[model samples]
Target: MRPFIASPSNARRTRSREGFMTFSPRKTPTTSQAPQGSPMLEWTGERYLPWIKDAAIAYEHLHRYVLAARLAEGKRVLDLASGEGYGANILAAAALSVVGLEIDDAAVQHARKKYKRENLEFVTGSVTSIPLREEHSFDLAVCFEAIEHVEDREKLVSEAKRMLKPDGLLVVSTPNKDVYRHESAGENPFHVRELDFEEFRSLLRQFFKNTGFLGQRIYANSTVWQIGNAHDARIDEFVIARDTAEFEFATNDRRVPLYFIGLASDAALGKFPGSVLIDCSNELLRQIQEALAWRERQSADRAETIASLEKAVAWRQTQLEDSLEAIASLRRVAGELETGNADLTARLRDATHQLGLIHASRGWQLILRLRRIRNKLKALVTFRVPG
Candidate 1:
């Protein structure tokens, strides 16, 4: 069974619940539900769209809202910069009334059309200057991942303070610049300003009398519990001790937190424990394995193609070598023929001179005269016989 919300009894505690928390993974809307021509908001690294099929992103974002549901129960909640309204929807499941305030008109329209509940409502308004008429109306103001997007961080916090009841609590979160600067791909274009741990705590402390900070980061751990049992359990994190070279129990995670969540209020804040939401479906690991398989297939195909090209190149080289050898042999035969022709021409020239000399000589001249006389006598005899 998938555990929903852990008990806040211990700072590090785990609990198992049946089906009380019903914040299930939302499915992608079909084309019939949202027609082909319908205009939907795009996720340009700015806002988290529910339709985006990334499990890590979903876990990072949905966990915050699900945790906020604990504080939102039976209170009038105001969700600041609620881009897609999913968070507000989560709060509405328990809150007396939930209002989502967004800066983008399109996002507001999209949220209004997509998520509908009697207790939940979405409005278009800036966090710095909310358009709500009454002040001190809400019991809790939740601003998750919106503190860094606006230019006036102070005013945004002040607005949340002004709109909150005298004992209202403001649960705000922002990217930890110290850790996020290295983790993220350069600077985030959408984030106008981001606050580190000190800056975030100081800013919230200035407005609220009581402030508590929490570090949010993703970690891999083994969970153990009694079978078919629901009970609050303690959490212990162990790390290798560098000096002793042995396992040591660490107080808190040593990893730098990617985000800092601040719970600020005028009243004394209650002790809240750390919580974890398990992706029971194991979606992230599955997707990563699938991606690795696809990349391996692509690499294999590329290797095969390269090998085929190499064979083709070798065959072409052999053909060229044979053609070159054949041409060389033909050239040698032509050279020999030229040499033979030269010798024959020289012999012919010498023979022609020799024959001319024979004709001009006395013996040759007498033989020619005798052959002419014989031919003339034969011709006369044949003519007389005929007469």
Candidate 2:
């Protein structure tokens, strides 16, 4: 977990997983109960491990505790920069006593309220300049992932060495510089400094007599996730090695290792426990697969609905087009009828004018008079013959 107490400046405080540690593939018993933003530290889904939405993120964030738990057994542990105290609480299960030191006041108060065992205690302090007065008292001092946040690396390392007994073990970790630098989209704005493996080793060598590093790489099942870290293609074998630093390098950068853990002591660390913890969020993975299936079903239903709407729209458009064609045909017929009526009216007016002209002629009047006289003479002749 990230802790800001060791950072170069006070502004570098967004450090994640630096100050915290918790046992169980899930989380510690205490911090899980309290909701984020209550008396306990806020359970930011993206930042904190216990209340994280994705199980894979939670696993990757908290698995360091599993690796460190083996070494801190039955020892008085000083968890530096213990932001939320869960890491210290987890170690408390195995350690004789755990003093969780944090600089952030809210986190310290939150931790005190959430995880209060007789063996577990929370204190407000910085890792670079540890506030603990008791020097050379602790059996083991553990700083999981807080070293890189601080500006003064040497001071933090020296402080950790100071807290531990003459033969106490100092377990510390940092993001591998080569992988973290390139693998990250860009430099983290929250991080003041990030170290490569060589730089990290070089830094640790100054304070600790013998520093043995153990790499923590997360691998996902093929069926489960297409995103996140996958096994290296060049990985031909998986065998137990006596040394903690021994790891088979992946051929490509696609499967770059996530973080590195170092076990520092005066003498050589011989024959560590062969057990390696896998941060494969199988439970969360199953849930995600189910959710994906549900989403696909929803998408198919939406597509069907959209197709039906488009078909209806096409049918309506066709009907409107046919109506428009029929209206145009009716308009043409109406135009032809109007033209025929206009021609007929013009012909009738012309005929009327010709008849009027004939009636007005002088020859026509003379013919009428002649016809009347002839009829009268014919009537007189017929009457005399009859007598």
Give the range where candidate 1 is weakest over 10 consecutive residues by summed lDDT: 14-23
How high a TM-score does candidate 2 get? 0.62
Q: What does candidate 1's lDDT look like per residue over 1-387, in tens digits?
A: 001211222122221121011122223242123323435765444567666666777788899998899999999999998987889999999999999998778889888887889999999988888899989999999998877766678888999999999999999888888788777656554455778888998999889999998878877666665677656555545543344766565555565678888999999999988887777788888989989999999999999999999999999999999999999999999999999999999999999999999989999989989999999999999989955
The alpha-carbon lDDT assigned to residue 41 of candidate 1 equals: 64
Error of 1 at 82 (Å): 0.7
TM-score of each: 0.72, 0.62
- Give one digit per residue, the lDDT tens place, for model 2 in 1-387: 333112223122344333322221222233345564447444432135465455555565567776666677888989987766777888888888899888777888888887879999888877877878999988888886676667777888899999889888888878887777765555444455778888888888888788887676656433333355665322233333223566543444344556878788776676554234444456676868989999999999999999999999999999999999999999999999999999999999999998888778888788888999999999989989955
Which window of 10 residues has the lowest lDDT sum in candidate 2? Answer: 3-12
**For model 1, what is the alpha-carbon lDDT of residue 309?**
94
